[model samples]
Target: MLKLIVNNLKERKIGLHELNSEELTEALHYAVANQDFALQREIGNHFTHIYDQTDEIPYWFKSEYDDDVTIINFGQRDKVVDWSSVTLEDCLPLTHSKHKPLLNGFKNWLLAVSDPLENGGAVIKTSTVKMRVEKVLSLIDAILLRSAALQLSLYHLSHITCDFWLSLFKAMSENGPINGVYDFTGRTVELVKAHVKSITQEQVNAFASKYPFVIRDIAEDDLTLHLAKQERVKACCWLYSQGYYKYGSSFIATGNGAVLAILLFEGKIASPSLNTPTSTELWLTEKERSTEYRPFNTENSKTSTAEATINTYISMAKLINTNIFKDNASSPSIEATKALSVRKINDLVILKPAGRTQTLHPDVVFKLTRQSFEFVLKFQQDILDA
Candidate 1:
């Protein structure tokens, strides 16, 4: 077992400092005999026993793979991850069952990396792990879709080159063979490709050995954040551009418009009043109850949702610049509220004002809220250009 552990460590390029072979061997034997490997207590309790004593070691004798292990946690450091509960068996049954041993070994790798006792490394927030997992799942779905189109299974593409991953991302960004249209900018695509290329050959070998490691790489990639940001901006743009609120973007630049947008955006004033004119407004009121905000990472607020919201806000700001300043035809309109907030005229989104319920076309409402609408169309371009 010691030989096996040492060989595994060497294969993974994980090095230990200060501890001699005898001490390291003794520690593993103690952990194996005394700790519950099933519960993954080896990392937490055993490492603490070895390293936590002040006279034993002043600093952690970590391997180059320490940060990589933390990164592989997918940002969920606080909560223990149950591989059984989060397995890909249901989605990729053929490969998953065939690769169970490899999967088990990789699970050991994951456990060894994230020591909650902080002997090995620091744990990250649970939310980040969840979000990364979600994003990776979506990307895998897209990849599988693309694979099916090519008449291939994931197993068939084992040990593929980074170029393969880059092409997959490119296809996803361009709305090519992928299921959904991503419409990511060329720069975003390039950046994503660069991220894919950044994976070391040794890291790729580690991932290729275990199917879940492939999934882990997908989750760990920078593309996950970019995808998260894009989706957020698109959702925000859709909500505002469709006239789901009391007032459109014409009022967005003003005090009242800002108040309305803020109220809706912040989930403060959730719905249209009982007297609101349109069914669309009523529908929006219901949707707002379940609305989620994801912002970019801020110095003070680095939570997953806050970071997503920040990214969306930045993308929206870029969109606003395009809509209000770059367009030659439409000047910024400062008008706030109409007599009636919103209504559906045939297929048009209608806004009526004080005098005689004067109607504006849905195009006019969309134009007034063009910044939000344009965000959906040009977010990636704006992000890269900025």
Candidate 2:
């Protein structure tokens, strides 16, 4: 486990040699400025250890480091300096940069959770288990660091919930393919798609081997209202079994033929709401009652329904992004939503959202939301403005 962590640190260019006395001094000042006594102690120990060493120091450290005894001894010596009164500006070059602070915070959190000494050495016993936990922590730390560097808010990071991580592990362990779509809520479909693409099969397998769990496969069905309704119910039930029941959304990544379904929970509920059927549902129902399978099975109706469903999802995606970001006082330019269009080529329904295109097979049923219909009414006005 120790070796694995060391290797990962090496890969990230965060080796022990990278932690110079100067950087450790800066960390100490930052901790002292924040009045974080615990962090101050940790940084102080590192700073004192590095400064006391007679051996060669890291390249980033200054050659005349012996001259600045006052800065180095700020937190190390017995001299009483008021931590609470110290402002950030007083720290000067000792302060961490924008993303570094968040990265440091995440690293601290990871260490706290995984450190056996802090947990009374009760959480982890075996080296194998420890290595697995560390791997997950490293993956999360990397994601958080990237998000911080990109200037994404804590709210955006919050969306990568514990459930999402658990589901990822489940997907890895389960040999059968998981059929689901990405949640398009909060205009995060593009971000989620990028993340999905970045994930390697090897990582999934490794996570799965570490923690094995079963995830039931969702079978593919023809694109129809009846099928969509049935699949939605099945999906909700599966999620409920996994202790997730609240909000649900799906998005498809046409490039990789990947579908991700995300389920979120808030408060407990006796039952989830089942709203009225859509026009496609009505058409399916009418066809079922007429005993005329040929009319309902016609290529024209299949193409039309498929196109309608894709359009509905695209509109909903736009509205969701608009409302979420607007509330947060940020406007996200969603080029994918703006470029969304659907066309029928012969019996097939082709959806082009941004540059990526997806063909809706007759065997797949696309899910739709109430917001999709509501937004479609003003589609023309919205498109012209965009």
Candidate 3:
């Protein structure tokens, strides 16, 4: 049983690019070792919605954002949780009506358990134990499989009393074999014992050190660590689903009087980057990044909370205050505006707050042409030129 517990954690080691601390790693272990439903929820939520900390978000994200974000397909990997292995049907109890916990027993357990997040112990009432167990298992599996990370943490995994966890798994195993529904109980233990090449603390620390998302907060660093990897960004996607900036890619084309910053997300913006060079690098200042935030609505259900998401994003943007955006266009606009001289056409800077929760790039690319450079230099933020 102990081996199974270790293997469950080992299989879902943290990602190399993650910016978590040893405390988080240990906390994750604690969740698995104990039957802490809140911790399990945290693990599941993180896996389903991590963003690429550094990926750029295009300008004018305040516009309507629509994205499906990352789809957690269980079949895609062989992690301990194996989301693909279990189906919704499989999760449903054989006879939910029959197995509902007896009221007195449930109330008794509820009082005994305490959540680390201060959400009060998760209630396993007679009405929801079956579903709750399934949910808990899902959370456990996700963390155990997805922890395949290399992010830094601040604590160490310690030995904890897991008699409750053992019983829970044993019970889940009996309910039609937790093969696909919560198999980590057995597999995770094996992986940890064997010293598999899962995520390492050094890797996680390196990631956080590079991004340093905030002055001294987990949210910002979490964002930064997720982004520095350059690709396969997890943090960015996490934000999109939260409805931060609307997501998409784009093609930049410069004309004589203005620059064309075409949005990849199929939508319309009444006022985009104006023709003025001030619009050239559409960068977001500290104030702007802090102000622009949205809510998460993956299921579009009222149950989804966006406050935690907003705080996380605001914290992250501060870390990448000056993260540079690449110039998409090779040529400059040649048109000249009345107010300013047409000496140069610099790159455009686009600011992305925790813009949205979807698969999106932090910035977009714009091609520069000589004609467009002249246009931007001569033009102003006025409508006549834009």
Candidate 4:
């Protein structure tokens, strides 16, 4: 078994070599988070022992597999199936067989109750069984890790926008010494790609093998969060240009890797060029706007086009820069409601709001208190005028 384990690891070693540095971190999360296999055996064994004495078979007490049904002297008999390639249904020729699966179950129950204790009823020892538990746990971890690797299901990045993600990547990707989220001295896409290269799978596998229970499966929650962010990205594209002007750049790369600001198309053009040493803005046209968009990392649902997604972003920028930023405090209630909606719209995060529902469009919705709704509008106006 040890040789088998070692060989499995060896064969996978080459495949893991291709993991980027960040991908490796997520992979490690999968590898390290699960319960030991010993626990499963202990739990399974306990069930067996309990059934041995009860004699009264619980309705829930079902064997791993099923056998055929029977009709015998006891009204209806059941045939119990042991480990075999043939299923219980196939084992007994229904035309001739008088017994069914129920009979086997009844018999087992009778056996259990007839002798709750065996020859003075001593406890069974299981220390030897534990020796291989760690190995089994490790093997299970590997199986899960491989599954995740094959499917790309273990991305654990925070629920931030891609613009922010890009910025962080830029900071971490640079050459030379790095420190935390700040690495301004280095710049360029190549630097970020290098950091991405740092991610791998084996590191995740080793860590996941340690905890075999709790973190057993890839987190579907994270995927939902990502999908929500994707929706936001799409919104930024489709909203009022996301506040852009002049050169028409769609996003802003900034903060020495600490932050990435996605410059959406602003509704109105600033007096000067969109980007100067101090300012950068993105631009968009009317066709790029969106009403309501879906969330990201979709495990369930139809796929949306990237172009459609971009439209929302553009609309957001234009709306903010024009109506919201440019001194338009027309609907303080509406603006606050928009932000509240943006922050938690059809996303993974479960946000339960108090009060009434504000329906901006057929696709967009908002749940907010009256006061909070007003505050959002005022805040949006401030951004526009600022």
Candidate 2 similarity to native, TM-score: 0.19
lDDT of 4: 0.28
From the highest lDDT down, the ranking of the candidates is 1, 2, 4, 3
Off by over 4 Å in 1: 1-92, 95-120, 148-159, 174-386
Q: Give each model a TM-score.
A: 0.24, 0.19, 0.16, 0.13
lDDT of each: 0.32, 0.32, 0.27, 0.28
lDDT of 1 by residue, 1-386 (tens): 56555554546555444447785766466557766363234344445453243223121222222121212333223222222222232344322454343233332222322233322344535554344333433333333334444333233223223344334433332232212212223323343344443445555444334322122222223342333332323322333333433353442211133332332222111111212112111121122334366432222211111223223222221221121222221111212111111121111211122343234557756775887767867787877788
Q: Residue-wise lDDT of candidate 2 within 1-386, one digit each (tens)?
A: 43443344436646444666765555556667768675554444453442233233322222232221111111222221121221122232211233233223332332333233333334444443333333333243223323433233433333443334333322222211111121222212232333344445565454334323212222344333222333333332332333332223532111111111222211111111211122221121122345443433323322222334444333332332322232323223444235434432212333223442345444543333455666777596887788
lDDT score of model 3?
0.27
Which consecutive 10 residues in model 3 have the weakest lDDT in total?
150-159
lDDT of 2: 0.32
- Each model's total of backbone clashes: 13, 10, 102, 96
Model with the higher lDDT, candidate 1 or 4: 1
Model 4 lDDT at residue 142: 21
lDDT of 1 at 344: 13
Best by TM-score: 1
